[model samples]
Target: MSQTTIQISQELQQELNRMKLFSRETYEEVIWNIIEDTKELSNEAKRDIAKARKEIAEGKAVTLSDLREKYKIQ
Candidate 1:
């Protein structure tokens, strides 16, 4: 595996050191959890946008005026 070096502040280094000693497993798990959550959100956003476009193409979507009225806007 290739190794990379990064620069960090003293405060961040101390916090990482404490996490390494106190919760090594959780630290790694948290990183993966964040990555997975980001991936899921990205996928959901793409799906929603695609569905909206399809609705527009099929003439199933409402106009901007309808949207404003639906939201109770003037």
Candidate 2:
């Protein structure tokens, strides 16, 4: 893969360093993780979320309290 160099502020560099998952993690990996987190959900995921919301509105979805009572959990 081709590589390019870009300049960033010292503060930004420190911030990116803090975002690393491990000491050996590269800045590219950290930036990619951030990009992935901000990406829009897939069409299927969006549809599933909308369906879940509708079910919740219609009271078709089970509540945590209900599950606890049904399973005899305190």
Candidate 3:
């Protein structure tokens, strides 16, 4: 792969260093992970979220407390 050098502030460099998963992790991997996390959700995921919200608003969803009581969980 082709490579290029770019300058970053010392603060930004330190932040990136802190984001590394391991001592050997590269800055590029950290950057790509940030990019992936900020990407938009897929259409299906969006629809599912909307459906779940509607169900919650309509009181069609069960509560965690109710499930715990039903299952005799403490």
Candidate 4:
């Protein structure tokens, strides 16, 4: 297969490295694995996500991280 080169920031590269499941997993495999996971979410969950995004765009929702911090979750 033909291959391509893309540039990513050092921080992003480190995050990708941290996501690797094994020493031999390639970047393509890692990206496709994430894509597969998003495709696996249920229709109800997907609709809820769409609704949440719309709410956030309307400035009507608190992000989970912010809510977690507000609740003092570790």
Across 1-74, the per-residue lDDT of candidate 4 in tens digits comes to 99999999999888888899997899999999889887878999989999999998999988889998999997
Show where candidate 2 strays beyond 4 Å: 48-74
Collision count for each candidate, in order: 0, 0, 0, 0
Itemize residue pairs with steric clashes in candidate 2. Answer: none
Please identify which of the two predictions, 2 or 4, would achieve the higher lDDT against the true structure: 2
| Candidate 1: tens digits of C-alpha lDDT, residues 9-68 | 899767655655345555455546657767745788889999999999999988989999
TM-score of each: 0.33, 0.62, 0.59, 0.52
TM-score of 2: 0.62
Instruction: Score candidate 1 by lDDT.
Output: 0.73
Q: In order, what lDDT does every prediction score?
A: 0.73, 0.98, 0.97, 0.91
Candidate 2 per-residue lDDT, tens place, 1-74, comes to 99999999999999999999999999999999999999999999999999999999998999899999999998
Superposed model 3: Cα runs more than 4 Å off: 47-74
Q: List the residue pairs that clash in candidate 3.
A: none
RMSD of each: 9.7, 3.1, 3.3, 8.6
